[model samples]
Target chain A: SSHATGYNSNRILAPYSVYKGKAAFSLTPSLPTFTKLHSGAVVVDRRGSIMVIFMHAIGDRKYDWENRQRFALSATEVGSLLTMGPQDSCEFFHDPSIKSSNAGQVRKSLSIKPHANSNGYFMNLTVVNNLLNTKEFFSVPVTAAEFAVMKTACSFALPHIMGWDKMTHQQSTGGTVGLQS
Target chain B: SSHATGYNSNRILAPYSVYKGKAAFSLTPSLPTFTKLHSGAVVVDRRGSIMVIFMHAIGDRKYDWENRQRFALSATEVGSLLTMGPQDSCEFFHDPSIKSSNAGQVRKSLSIKPHANSNGYFMNLTVVNNLLNTKEFFSVPVTAAEFAVMKTACSFALPHIMGWDKMTHQQSTGGTVGLQS
Candidate 1:
């Protein structure tokens, strides 16, 4: 029954975009939000733009809703991360479209680096808003397990976004998205 | 010199716990924060706590600072997830210490479930604060690659947290932390 799928069953029935192939794995990292939980996904949209989508829930328990926001990264942007070193922090979202305006938001910078605290080392995400002035939003944490998934997802999604059609089942020499041999 | 390690070199030098067997992999997921980039780590601390630590940067980037936070889960908590299905939302952080108080914060429920949007399917993280009145905070998304790493990290970190000593290099029958053979 559709009811077995929980709170999101209704949304699945909606006119959401149909994705081909299968998204094999994903993880929801724990965040330090005082109120709600945060989630995300990576998909190659119909336009073939590799998008990292995030869902932020707002309002009170009485009336709750989500603000679905995302940023598209080019194939080059996603590919660069494949070679990212421990000491390196790569800024990928330089697209001016990010500044299309979410409350005077000029630039949103997303960088992935290894971070540590008194507890231990972590995979750190540093996202900052370079508006007229820089204001920080939130910093979330993911487990080492989750980080591996992210890297693999990028590798899997890369071939899709780079115009490698899998449905016809023909391999494209130009669309190999993996560790270079 | 340690200066080559970037902003976290100082933390690495501090008396923070020394982790053996090398964490090998970690990732910082892209978060939808108005201000800061959030990062996380997976480690078996000195006390053997399988901690998922997160750093949330606050204040201004000029006088910027971070609030280092984390939650520890038992081997059982980590193991239960190995079998989690698409429809399951497993609540892992039932630890009462989470209520130790960061401004009247009570039960913080951390759940992992698959979520979807007009974009595509996402590995959803639903972290809700069950305080006096329910307040929704942030729902962050992770790519499929990142999520796969999370699961593998759990498989890796679980043995360490479950009293599987590696320095001496002897396998234990009770310390298996992977899929059932």
Candidate 2:
């Protein structure tokens, strides 16, 4: 069965002597990659910083020697791929660590065409499209100066971001990811 | 103003001689070519015998100058192109001398993707994925012998076929080229 997957992240906390101690914690947060490999074609594009809730994308990635690819599909198209039938719920994945405490966060539109072949799907702690949204979250523990540098370097090296999570149960806030049998 | 367009036919015709006489004709058809000029990405396929129906895929060639090199929609994404509004009537160039009356009596499925670039989107009579369906009345006449040769040639030339159409009409049951304004 195709299941959601993710990657690892690491950061060093520099030493800054406080009056009595060094104040700080550097984020080496675990992030998710935009696309994981299956041998086909890969198209990557980054939209401006903005959040989206309009369309929902659900997927299954099973590792099999014979099968290696992700077929792009819209929500409706994915529904057709459903073998469990309508109304059935299944476990799925979503990266919520970056979700804004407020829903108004504009995560710029970022889309990628991950086909059957790819070297490796990489990810950072932020969404590639919305530099602003990524900054807002990064600035929480990191300084503006540190955020800027990290964003740029990480983006160039690891552009694809978003951890894959498993959805055990889904509530119809508007859309659902899994099919329940 | 109308000129370059292509047709995709999904039907069965009797192009064989012996039992058929005059008015029956068959022309060896070619495969269609699909490509996006900007990307230089190309794909090709083949299909059954298609009646070429038009005589002047010229003016439908949309251009103010002879220096033009391609169609506006050709090799472009459909989302960027206008949605094919309701148009039942279309125009095609007819060359009866080509004589393809009893063209393909065999079962055939023709599919054409509109030339997003050129005005006259005459389909290159190829098998492809973009095709939705086609009309019957507007087909060109071809002989049964010609149909056989055409089909065999098409099957052989599958890879060379570029998905292109010189006709510019949506297939429909209505005999009219388009609805009256």
Best by DockQ: 1
Model 1, C-alpha of A155: deviation from truth (Å): 1.2
Give me the displacement of residue B22 in model 1, in angstroms: 30
In model 2, the runs with Cα more than 4 Å from the true position are A1-72, A78-181, B1-22, B25-29, B32-88, B93-181
Model 2 earns a TM-score of 0.18
Question: What fnat does each of the candidate structures reach?
Answer: 0.00, 0.00
lDDT of 2 by residue, B26-99 (tens): 23233343332333322232221232222212344322223211111111111111112222112222222234
Tell me the chain A TM-score of model 2. 0.18
RMSD of each: 23.3, 25.1
| Residue A66, model 1: Cα distance from true site in angstroms | 3.4
**Residue-wise C-alpha lDDT for candidate 2, range A12-72, written one tens digit per residue:** 1111100101111121112221222355322122211111111111233212223211112
Error of 1 at B52 (Å): 23
Candidate 2 lDDT score at position A47: 15
What tens-digit string does per-residue lDDT give for candidate 1 at B1-181?
A: 7788775566432112211121111222111112211222122233344454333223332211132334455554565554344454456544344446554354444555565542211322223445546543323344445556566665555434433222111111122211122
Q: How well is candidate 1 docked (DockQ)?
A: 0.02
